[model samples]
Target: MTPNQATSSTTAHLKPTLGSLQLWGIAVGLVISGEYFGWSYGWASAGTLGFTVTALFIAAMYTSFIFSFTELTTAIPHAGGPFAYSKRAFGPLGGFFAGAATLIEFVFAPPAIALAIGAYLNVQFPEINPKTAAVTAYLVFMTLNILGIQIAANFELAVTLLAIFELLVFMGVVSPGFSMSNFTKGGWAGQDHFSLASLPGMFAAIPFAIWFFLAIEGVAMAAEESRNPQRSIPIAYIGGIITLVTLAIGVMVFAGGVGDWTKLANINDPLPQAMKLVVGDNSNWLHMLVWLGLFGLIASFHGIILGYSRQIFALARENYLPLFFAKIHPRFKTPHRAILAGGAIGIAAIYSDELIKIGGQSLTANILTMSVFGALLMYIVSMLSLFKLRRTEPHLVRPFRAPFYPYSPAFALICACICMVTMIYYNLLIFGIFCLFLALAYVYHAMTVGKRSPMQDEADSNSMTTKTPAR
Candidate 1:
């Protein structure tokens, strides 16, 4: 490897030792589970036809973005992820926004996942209440995270396996009752119905559907902990995206058709409802197994918290945030402070009005939509950085350069911008709120804790050395 590649390789395996397969499992689980709410909302918005088209659009964009990230991540395998890449390519200000955007995505995502789990459980046990269940689930995962990375990875692996198994069984039981007529029964045109006019609605749902595909890039956050970051990060990144797209398509194809879109859309956990419809309500065994799927959803949340905390830790180390947040446990070598901070934010979000609401019509729905908007904004910035870096650092060693160069990054940038525009069209208020927060964060970072230039710090160090060479 060249000098830069060697540095990248060394930094990639800087800390705790996590296997490639385990990382891939965690990434897949987090991305798939994050979409539970989106799937339900998309189905409600455009029915089955709308949901399927939206799913395809989001999946395609996500696939392309992951490839772009794979190239960047392998070239510079560091823990700060997009933030580090942006800083190197642009400067501190650009890096601040990228890091802030990531922090928003990670912090908000956990509660969203928790809320989905709570909603699903509430469906099975209405008396328990969604808020209580949501809080309880969040706490459980927080505890798992506090325990440490190895334990979290092991738990994630187990949950992903069970989730995959549950998906297969669901597909098998529902396949026997598949109806070809269901595909075209609802027609391909209308508002409450599925039609060509609904195309806008379908496009609107892309952001929501994209939620399910969010955490695929999270593997990059764990780069510092992976066994062989150059090889491991890219493999996990590509592999995770492929796995999720395949599963999503399979589920959409197997879960009957858009004819009963209204019924399926109304239900929070569509897979269970679809299974119930397929098996005539006589399969008690299937009901229990469907509930097991909830565990998978919870596992996905666990992975989200784990990955998000690491990003926080990385930012802290770079002095973008408080130095205390950079603390790593001496024995565990894990970012306990950052993990606790993430857990606290997640707990707060769980209580937010948006998370407590039921349907997609409430403030919680607005925020969830805004989260998608925020994520796409970050994507736009990161993709731009990729192109900028190529021009500015032509000789920078890149172990894995993105294929097609400008075209690949350009494609991702365009798709992300399109998604953001669609989000604004659907709900201008939410997008406005998202941009407002980012602006506020940028101002805060600039005024309160602007990072010092590396050259200045280097000069100070050299002066000190020259003043006392033998002391």
Candidate 2:
């Protein structure tokens, strides 16, 4: 096997053009799609009030998770994000699992967002088939990502501002017509009143709650490309989380309050649907929402494609994946191969589900849950990494630290465990598929890379005179 002597140089060699504001733009832009859809899916599992309760629980989880996670990002400041942390804390195998989960989250996420983009456009102009629109969205964004980080970050900033504005406008327009009665109309769908039976629904609703804040951690993936990741990572990470929580609550209360929350549950474009109900089909608000609301989905879809490429590039640079994925454009200095490769995977995922026509349901939600499953699993592993690192590598420099030390990471870890179990319970089919993929990856690593796990590799590197890859 080729040793990772060049890994450090190649990984750290990435261009660093991103500032704190651009990082904030990418962080927020990466997740603004959550404000668009999928959170309402929780309502299908638990009604409006129950879903709101679930949101609050998840908000706590994310608040704690980001605080704990930021310290790792600031301290480590690697493009691999969770993979680097887990590798440092646990070893190659742990890093693989963490990386795989992140891959599952990022590689699978854009297609879902692409599907949403199509759905949003289709709602405005039915002549546009969602499948066609989704493919187009992938092609356009992949091109933008391939151009350069500077261009991508600038675009992310512009659209992120528009998406944030759109959400505020949505809340304002919907608030005037919101009825408290409508909010509680279906607070708990299956339960006449609160009961023990209602508990599982809350657990089941966890993934949907995750929809509100998924991919926020992806900001860490841009560490190699950031101007001053040490200072910028914490601000962008914390600021992004705060912005999302407020939007999550505002959209939840206002949208549910405007009309039948149950009807809006699980739909592709809940905001537009909710607005149309309140202002009629031809209302200016509906027009503005349908036209501009696309920005929210586009922001996330575009931003996530950028994130996934960096992750793919990072892993490949470390020899965790094929070397071909590590290739950077000579002129652009971007991981063009990784970007195209991820786009190909996303497009294939979109069409495979489209052709199979899974159980007469749109694969968008299923794929979404699948991505959430990966994210929750990664979160659990990463929080564990934080504690492990603190114990084992206490002297490592940390520009930022979690406010509550053990408590913050501990709380996030616990919540991540619960959310992961909940995600598995809710998404058995996808979980099974992910397991099969994991087993195959392990088999491939054992045979090709030999039995030397990431831990062993790190040990080897430390003892060797040759320079090792960046963590």
Candidate 3:
């Protein structure tokens, strides 16, 4: 069957289903825009030493970790995503922390992406205010998202292809100028180079490198909306990561070869600068390609917002959040209210100057480490939940079981722990601050809201029923 016919068939099987291609598109867009650009920016700052090693490390980590997630997501394709899986596997509270951390990651990621767009815009239009661009991009995507998921998904697909194509074409055009010798120009700089006495600076670079791999988890967030999520979600998760890793490595290698490592390292927006070198000055066509890539960035923001809003909607439905956020639009069959709430947060984040500062750090260096810290917390809980559920619900009909049983889950947990230790050792202050916020949020949520059960609402509804007087 043709693509349209296939999509129609898939849609008929499940209401509110996102086709596999669209799911892939959403995953790609979210990972590329939300994670990749920031990652590349981070890599740029660390120079070749950090980039080369960290890229390899991330590729290894992502491959192993994703297989584990694919198993979980495919087994339990619920709206709550990781939160739902955790609840079923561990317990409500375990699920709560997982949901909370995932929520924070999704919430924080959009602003970071928005700030990247604003930074790129600042480069092209030096006269335009960065804050204004950031706010405008956030609002535009927010509006796009509010229209509904289909619109957002379609836009994501289009921009994802555009972004990939732009990068590929740029690479092809610049391939002729590739010079392998440039790679070694900036040989590994020691700790003394950055005024540090020991190897802490080298270790400091891990988080930045880790940042490049951040959005591989986004596929789980799209589980509820995916067409045949049991199959599609896993595929998207695995495929999206592979695609990103391949493209990223290719672009970085090609860009590194085109000029001395120092030149590419110095330019904040490497693609446009690389294009300038290849296409020469006054290349408006290349400028237009960069602009299209920026739109892809914006589309990436929309995809994350789409995934995140659904996550919040799922939480609210479970009574973990306010009921108001749970309301879906009647006609559109979309989580309209939750989308607005997520967008509002993104807009608020644009106002923070600190976001810009954080965005400038090395990809494999700082943010990645911190993000991994948060992601690892969720992963550990998720893996433990997998084991917890195996014992608790022995007969639970899992469509897809993780390979190697306890070994798989055990391995994932170990990897997560290792990443967590690395994060703490590398940047204790930032990681500690994030944990503190999570702790405070949990305490406040527990004290004020957790005590009340969803069952109480049903009981109250029964009690308020009108009784007819004896007639």
Candidate 4:
């Protein structure tokens, strides 16, 4: 047998069961949590008006980014997502950094979402501790993911649909209270007027603004398991981005206009709070908002568990992580070990929430910032890979080319660079912590996985080949 055939024969692949519908579910579910809670934190720094402006620019970046990123995803269609793209374009070291950054984005994001899940439940049952609920969420969803992909994906679709419906209902119910005067008053950096002086707060708010659409790129990680990646991926990505952008703007505007926007700016359950302003605390609609809002948080939490596990599995399969994590469950055909490992890290972060304070920010805020930092770095790397591969691998089969080519990716790249700089400036301590983690990861890579010879590296890459050929 050929060496590539032998290598492929021995490797355990993720079962191909997901299609366009499930792909859309995974894409939107992966990011639905941002709508539930994290984005409101931007209001604290930039106020309603300034934060709205920040969100617009951030939204543009994501719209352009997903359009550009889809090209790389369809061409490679690997579980490693950005790691695989960077590896092809810039070799192993580039892959290592991209993988590390992607890991940070996926791994760190869940704890914050889990905590929000807990906070939402706490609103109804005050006795339930947020941290306990957070850890419980990690355990429950990880088990679901470990059981199988289809089952987990089906669940994601259900919750994502419910979440989307809830947001629409929220906007509809709050329509009466959405006064333009309330929204525009003190909107720009807590001032009635917008000026250059508001720029720092606007810049500082970039990470929170990014929270609105963070992890949407995680959909690419599922490319390996797709039934028809080329067709399904472009559909899922384009449809998902449009859906998320609409919900983000709708929820933000409706909530901000409902009364004092400042009161909803820094809380975990902003939707429920905003709804209570319109419908009263005892209103069934308010209760419904609290209950249904869990769907949004759960969708993102569960979806991210799926995203992070695939990433860990991909890294391990490529030798960047321990081989133990690469093992697929015999009967279930899922990356059980990788799922449990990521869940453990998330649970640890949950327990450490209060303990790991930076700049006096809440655990959700701190972790959200860290996740955005990772995301922005990965975005920069992924766009660079796209540009490099066009020049380097001219013969590569691209089923879906990013429109506007140089300009599309360049705009995405510039925006990502700007966001990264602003995040570092405002979050020095968290940025340092992020750098230290990368440095340690690099050292570990240097000692172990980085030592793979050319032949071995080729074999590893071959073993990771997509199940469906590019169109």
- TM-score of each model, in listed order: 0.88, 0.94, 0.83, 0.96
User: Against the correct fold, how does model 3 do in TM-score?
Assistant: 0.83
* lDDT per residue (tens digit) for residues 324-394 in model 4: 78889998899999999989988888888555566888888998988988999899999999999899877
Model 2: per-residue lDDT, tens digit, 1-471? 235544432443578789999999999999999988988888887888888888999999999999999988887777788988888788777888998889889998899999888899998899999989999999999999999999999999999999999999999998888998888875875554666677778888887788899999999899878888888998899899999999999998999999777789878899999998789998888989987899999999999998899989877776778777888898888899999999998999888865423533458877887788789889999999889888987767778889998998899999888887777776676778778767887676566464344454675323211122233
lDDT of 1 at 5: 21
Which residue pairs show collisions in model 2?
8-469, 8-470, 92-454, 92-455
- Whole-model lDDT values for every prediction: 0.70, 0.84, 0.65, 0.89
Number of backbone-clashing residue pairs for each candidate, in the order shown? 6, 4, 15, 1
Ten residues in a row with the worst lDDT in model 1?
462-471
Model 4 spans > 4 angstroms off: 1-10, 462-471
How would you encode candidate 3's per-residue C-alpha lDDT over 1-471 as one tens digit per residue?
233222211221113558888888877887776322544443344555555665666566666667777766776665667877786655557767888877777776776677677767876788988668877887787778777778878888898998888777767887887877654455344221333332343444455555556656777766766767766876787778888788777877777677755555423366667667767756875677568768657766778888778778767665567666777777667777888897787677567446423534432233334455667678778888777777876656555566677676677677667667766775666677678868886785686454344454333222222132211
**Which candidate number would show the highest lDDT if scored against the true structure?**
4
Off by over 4 Å in 3: 1-15, 34-36, 44-46, 190-202, 263-268, 354-372, 404-409, 448-471
lDDT tens string, model 1, 1-471? 233222221222236588888888878877767434456566556656667777787787787788888767766666778887877777777778888888888777777667767777876777987768878887777777777788888888888878877777777777777776774455232343554677866776776687668767777787767776667777788888888888877776666452364566534466777777766655874566558778668777888787788888777665667656767777666777888898788777667675434334653455466567657767887898788878886756565667776777788889888888887788766666667778887776676443444553233222211111121
RMSD of each: 6.5, 3.3, 9.1, 2.2
